[model samples]
Target: AERVWYPLWDAGLKLGHQVGTVAQLLDVGAENLETATSLLAARVVAASSADGEALVDDLAERALAQWKGRSRQNLDQLQGAVAERHARFGEVAFLLEPDIKEARGGLRDVHSLFWVEQATVPILREAESAGLAAAFEMLLEVRVELHRLTGQRADKLLLELQDDVAAALGLADADVLMAEVSAAGRTIAWTGEGAARRTLRASRRRGPMKALSGIRRREVAPGLVLDDGRLELTDDADLGDPLLVLRYAASAARHDAYLQRGSLERLADHAEPLPVPWPAEARGLFVDLLAAGPAAIPVIEDLDQVGLFVLLVPEWEPCRSRPQRNAYHRFTVDRHLMEAAAEASRLVGQVERPDLLLVGALFHDIGKGYPGDHTVVGVDLLTTIAARMGYEGDDVDLLVAMVEHHLLLPDVATRRDLDDNGTIRQVADAVGGTVLLGLLGALTEADSIATGPSAWSNWKAGLVRELVERTSHVLGGGDVGDVVGGSFPDAAQQALLDDGTFVVRGEGLELTVVAADRPGTFAKVAGVLALNGADVLGASAHSEHGRALSVFRVGSVLGGEPDWARIDEQVNRALAGRLAVAARLGDRSRTYRPIHLTARPARPTMTVDNVSSATATVLEVTCPDGVGVLYRITRAFAELDLDIVRAHVQTLGSDVIDAFYVRDQFGAKITDPEHLAEVELSVLRWVAVDF
Candidate 1:
């Protein structure tokens, strides 16, 4: 109790001249009863005169009016508050283990619905009240039980506690409990969302606005219309046509138009069920909707909110808001599938079969809700879904294959050696042929990009592309040698003979340094560059014929143009071993937090490949990224007296995947297993450090 009111009391002491006593504090609160109500409701004053009591009553009446009345000022304030809350909790439904109080569709949503209902216009009062009430009651009960079982103030319904909570609530199983909770959350969330929409429309009606010229309308067939920025139905609309729903959805998606709430409600309550073995037009429109890319997300969300999507695809229920229970996935299973399909739409021109790509993306995770291997189970489910959509036998076979191996590209690209002929051939055999391979490649990119930022990096993309090209080469009966030959540019010799080159490119400066090949060339270059107040974004290095060429992509750390002459002088001095690059870089590294040291385990991996190139041993490194990581890596190599022939550096979120081609002092490939192990251990240890 003291913790709750002490701040108010402390403020009173600061603001009031004589607020040391309790009675004096109450007097101060009574004089400013509105502030008191905001801080500690209703009990601010111990007793009051008749006139003071009447003043309090009047204040209460005004406060209620502000909350419940539809004045322009009140509605505007409400809108701002709603937007703030949406930003805070909009993605709560997708959490792996959601908080019962603060998460979207949780207890707060129920309260928000009540507040919105109180302020809604009369015509929109009972739009979905029954569902809202039921959801409120169920969530209140769960919240109470959750607090009791945990013997404290707990709101997150964790997986470990789900079974116990279910038993305590007299439920049959945890799944039943979770489904009930999810349903309640959705009900409250949808109702609140609908209320907010109505309030915004009401607020707009009072503002001075001009109607669009010529009664703008984009007709979807004969009845449905995008009229004046809202979806509507004409007088002669056919509610019995199942294809009308898909047509309207497709039109709204393609045109990026908002659907009217009333029209959505009518469709949800009265739309005709789609026939089994659905017609070609219906399936085509569904594909068109998916092909709209990210514009379709809003339409799909609106349909799901109004309960119309389930009527189109009943199999969607299991995947709705289903948690993936991993850090890598950012959305629920159904949302992830839709996002993947949307992402695939952006690459429609890249594939021979856009329709198949859309279908495969939508059904990629349909088996996640079931037990056993999801790939095999998803293949079975895809067969049924395809048949229901009236696909031909050959199309069904293709869809099954697509779903059965959706994870093939990313899994193989990241985990296997793409340089191996057997690896490329294995992918080709699994993919069947060149055409299917193309589709799989496109689908893989869409799926990975939609997974999360960390799931796909430039380096990973390059690896996947390489794998695909090599596989294509093999499939076309081309020699591996023909596909793997490219020469480094002669820029190094020119730069060595003169000054280095610095050019501004897209918000950063690209510095090209050329010098005689040495063990610590990269270290000196990176260190001297960092010492000049340059934040290195990326870099690449290559050395051949006793000459080294390096390019550093960097942005100014001090928000000004880099002093090119100073940078050039320092870099040269560092390369000549006159400057202590390591000590200088170490000093600068202390300003930034040691984020990588405390970061989640990166599962650092090292692979020494002797087959990729005959001349140099390729050391592929993957680990958590950090400030000055590249410097530490190159420094470690310099310490070991290993010359880096080439280096490729890439970062995806916090993870860094790099490859370095190196040789011993004698210019021989480090083939001995014991020596390779020592090198791998050294690199991994340096990578694990923050500086």
Candidate 2:
């Protein structure tokens, strides 16, 4: 094929005609056959005929006119078409691994914008077109390289292939490559959306009701006006005023209106820089903008796109479009920060200083764009950032503490034994007081919810809440033991224990098992729940005298409500040793093996912590999640003759971090080094079992 086309391509190039690859030719042919045919005819005639110059010009004009006519005819249907396209391939601009061809901000969107510009009057200005073209070329180059590397027709930039693609493009790493992709994709998507909106407005202005809709305007603030549903500066507005930008952004966000592209460009070109140690009014406006919640996202996005946001916060430049590169994060660093701030806005009523909360949430992950531990770096960054934003000493310190401890609550709640007194005291000491603790608590939730779905769950939230309550008690001058001790066997569970009878009850998604305190009690219940298709999200165990109480928070594998009756009956049989739980689980695993194990699983890890709790040994296990994982791990503990005091199970993406508070058969912490090694080995062996 190359031999046949090489001479023709050379002749066409010599004739001063542009040439593209076979794929480009196929794309043009697919989009419009007449245009493709006309271009081909023009190239062939110019290359083969002596009088082909004049004929080529006519064919080119014909193709241009055809495109212009099509654009004019389809102008009314453009918005719906864009929406349909977005519906098919999602509209998020910051997908960790994105499709370069068909995604919302991908090449297709750029094409749509090009078509829009070919209408009766161009929708995009010259500068906008040039920028969009550059972004389009960047994405196209990446897509081509991706196809070359994979040796297949590929578009989606998968995580596994990112590093190789980056190297092929002479980029530093996958993060750098993805950051470029993100920036380009965002440019295209933003421009395409603006063009579509302008097209709709232009079409409306030319309709029969044009006279009635003639440029409705309202002055919304000192220098800002709402013109035809868009926010823009008034003719007399002062661009020299440093506070104007913040006021404009805050007003646009609060009113939930679009920022006019012309106004945005003017501001980007002429707006003054905000003074360091911003004035109280400027700070207020910034907080008000963040207080707009989800509505602030698009407004801030527009500012970032126009290079206005970075001008306000110079430290924000590195974070723009920075990829998080993990399954746990749903957005880039900057976007996640904005989303976290937005989520925090909903809980403003819960915090003492909403301003501090809003600012803290926005800057919690700012240091992620830098080196070193994000928490430690974040503290140093916020110390200066907050001060520049007009915060006083106390406020600055509070914000710094917020950034430093943003992950503390969730980390402790999910991975540590919350019932441990040392755990509660450590959190209290770190938090310092109720005021800072409250800010961190709200920030933790907002940060987790913004991170991703798997980052926050009911079980995890419950644990954090329990931790916060215990920490708050200590900060409020109450005894730590009062909060952490002797509260498990509440009146109801104690009455069941007082009767000294085996009782198993299942209600909705909760299962409670009370029986004689034994080594295998927790393991037996976990196995029964797994066998019954109940996913154990969390569980806790407590024993008073010779009786034990085990409570499980569960969900069905197939979703909806759990079958409590069947689960209850199975628990009875398993606890009584009548059911073969292990054999049954093995058979189930063999019948319904996971299809997602194609990738090698991470090596399982076990950590024995005797320092966190004074009364029990804490075993933290990290491994890939599976159906019978909990059963296997707990079964190991039971076989080791360890008493299960409490268990905290948290599933993060494909992995689970399960922390167990265990004791020796004599109800003491396991302190022997050899015994600890044996415990770790047994758990690892059980976790690696196929069943």
Candidate 2 lDDT over 190-283, as tens digits, reads 8887887788788777876488574587899988998776898887889888888889999999998989888888888898778888999999
Q: Local distance difference test, per candidate?
A: 0.71, 0.82
Off by over 4 Å in 2: 1-73, 149-151, 212-215, 271-273, 415-423, 457-470, 478-487, 495-505, 514-521, 531-533, 544-547, 563-604, 607-612, 684-691
Q: Which clashing pairs does model 2 show? A: none
RMSD of 2: 6.1
lDDT tens digits, residues 1-691, model 1?
4544678666443232232333444444444423333322232363357776665555555544544543454446545665676577554456545677777777776655544555555424466777778877887888788888876667787766777888988998766676677767777776676677666656555555324333576675688887655677766777777887888898888878767777777777778768989899989999999999998887888788777887888788778766564456667687788999999998889888889889888888889877788898898888888988989877888888888878887766765545445556677778877777787888888888888776786767887888788878877887665654343435443445344343222223767777787778887777777677665654555565666677666665577767777778887788777998767766777875434321143688888877555667778787766566777777778878888766666554456677777788888888999988888778878767654
lDDT of 1 at 399: 85
575 Cα displacement, candidate 1 (Å): 4.0
lDDT measured at residue 569 in model 2 versus the true structure, 0 to 100: 83
Taking all chains together, the TM-score of candidate 2 against the true structure is: 0.83
What's model 2's lDDT at 133? 87
TM-score of each model, paired residue for residue: 0.67, 0.83
Clashes of 2: 0
Off by over 4 Å in 1: 1-54, 63-70, 80-190, 200-248, 251-282, 306-336, 363-484, 491-508, 527-540, 553-589, 594-601, 608-618, 635-643, 662-673
Per-residue error at 237 for model 2, in Å? 3.8
